[model samples]
Target: MTENPGFLLTVLAFVLVIGPLVFVHELGHYIAGRIFGVKAETFSIGFGGTIAGWHDKRGTHWKLGWLPLGGYVRFAGDMGAASQPTAEWLALPPEERAKTFQAKPLWQRSIIVAAGAIVNFLFAILILGSFAYLEGVPRTPPVIAMVAEGSAADRAGMKEGDRILSISGRSIGDFEDIYRIVRFSPIEPMQIAIDRGGNRLSVDVTPGVLVERDRFGNEYRMGQLGIGKPPAVYDDIGLLEAPLVGAERTWGIVRLMVDTLGQVVTGRRSVKELGGPLKIAQVSGEAAMMGWESLIGFIALVSINLGFINLLPVPMLDGGHLFFYAIEAIRRKPVPVEAQEWAYRGGFALLVSLMLLVTFNDLTSFGLWQKLGGLIG
Candidate 1:
């Protein structure tokens, strides 16, 4: 069958977006390994059967593969890119063993493993900083624009043009700060400090609970104070100040992610919101079509999430490796190879399952499967 134009665009966009980001990620690991005197046997940009490969002066086999999904860097004496230990590697001579990743001191090995995520985070911060520097940083004051009629804000005596000074005993500097508080305090009655008609007054506003659905039908149960935004004002930040704002913005995104994850765990949020590669491809393609600025912002977001996700303690990931290293640090020795192998196996399986589930959701969201089913019927 002939490929669809839209499908081609998505595939191209996915590769363009994910390929360089992943390369940057693996490069972080590779650079760290080289710095610590570990010999990189292979520095691959993708997986599956290799399309073309060549050896560098240092004997690191650099290759591109058929799949543009992900990349890896295999160090000498390591079994593969994930840096799993091998029996043969363990049996190497002392000099050779010294060059293996497993042979490094705890701190060095830990740093090497954590470097990828750190780089991702830094990349995001830099991108965000650049965006803020180019476009003025938003400095929206906490002034009410419109309150939903008969909504929680209306019932609490909130009015148009009222400025929110604080919520739940915490002061608010930006409009987003107020939403941050109400979004998390789903069940609590908020003690709102408002500036109304040039007089400071306190009011109790209990946020209402509502279920919001995304385009993919992913549902979110959130606390809404029913306050809308006024016209935004931008603050022209200095070059030095932009990075600080970017860092703060990155932290805010991280906090929001953590809150969402917590809500998911507590059954207050639906797992449908959890997406995978296909969702990323769709979003990336859409963002790219919007504009370079939007695409860059989306890529920055993905980078942050990529870094955070890899830090998860599940096996077969950077975080998983660091977790084992933590155990080794405490025990004064590495975790047994056999135990690690099993853990990695389980982790890989779980990761695959999640990928499949999310891919299915993506297909469903795109209505591709339904169309295919129609043809079959």
Candidate 2:
């Protein structure tokens, strides 16, 4: 199993990673809808071509689709396809259109739609925070964990367990500080002061440029000082602290996502680097191979992506719907149905196009496209 080829590994990875994360996301919306009395017609685990399905007492159809990329919830009178009314719904007079989604208050409708993405972010934070608190964060204490063989750090005589006291006379705190210095440091000679063998020593090493990928697929060269991180000493806290830490971490990730988007919009980053489902599956399989902890970590990471994606100000998405609500709140009436239709059409096209591009990139990155090219060549 460990030696399995890439295609099988990628498929299994997609199932494990995308499947549960998406289910949890849709679950958020489904539960919120039920709580708020907005009848859901179907809760599906994928898009297009249902593989299996069952109906519930609440008149909701649960389904597993043949395609495993993504899922959706069909609400009663959802203003689009994917739903059908039961006899009871049809039996109701025109005057009693209460159970329809359109009948719900704008605020309630917004929350129900937004819950899926919100829950995804919350899930990420909670999971990461729990992991952090449980095992303690891996802290590279101004100290080297492991020096990579023949790397810059190893060549500079940086040994495992050697605590870096300073860099160019600036005192160091934790591993992050070292990373900051190393990642952004100019490719020039720099002095590093370390406490090795209980004695302080200073050595000069030149930072080297290494290529790395950002969350977006853009590659950039950055300064590198190769060193691994050691496990932090676990310091337990009250139950309340865990959630707080989780929330802060979640917010930070959200901020990072927002910043990345800004960079893309500002032309400081490449939009083509944006990854879609295929890339996620590849990452998931890679993470899974590392360990359960790594897989769970990837889940937390993707949860953040799910949350942010839903918040896009495009119609048919949670954020897009919210944007309409905002306009309604300002104008004191719903946006014209025609306007919404146009917006949704545009958004759907943009989303679909983006998906196609990312899928292509994913295949290309996995060498699938390259292999096909080779066969033809």
TM-score of 2: 0.74
TM-score of each: 0.85, 0.74
Span of 10 residues, lowest total lDDT, candidate 2? 79-88
Q: Evaluate all candidate structures by whole-model CA lDDT and list the values in order.
A: 0.83, 0.77
Query: What TM-score does structure 1 among the candidates reach?
Result: 0.85
Measured by TM-score, the strongest candidate is 1
Q: How many residue pairs clash in each candidate?
A: 0, 0
lDDT of 2 by residue, 63-100 (tens): 99988878988777665521224556667666555767
- Which residue runs of candidate 1 sit more than 4 Å off their true CA positions? 1-5, 80-87, 90-93, 160-171, 178-224, 372-377
Superposed Cα deviation of residue 1, candidate 2 (Å):
18
lDDT of 1 at 83: 59
Q: Tell me the deviation in Å of residue 321 in model 2.
A: 0.6
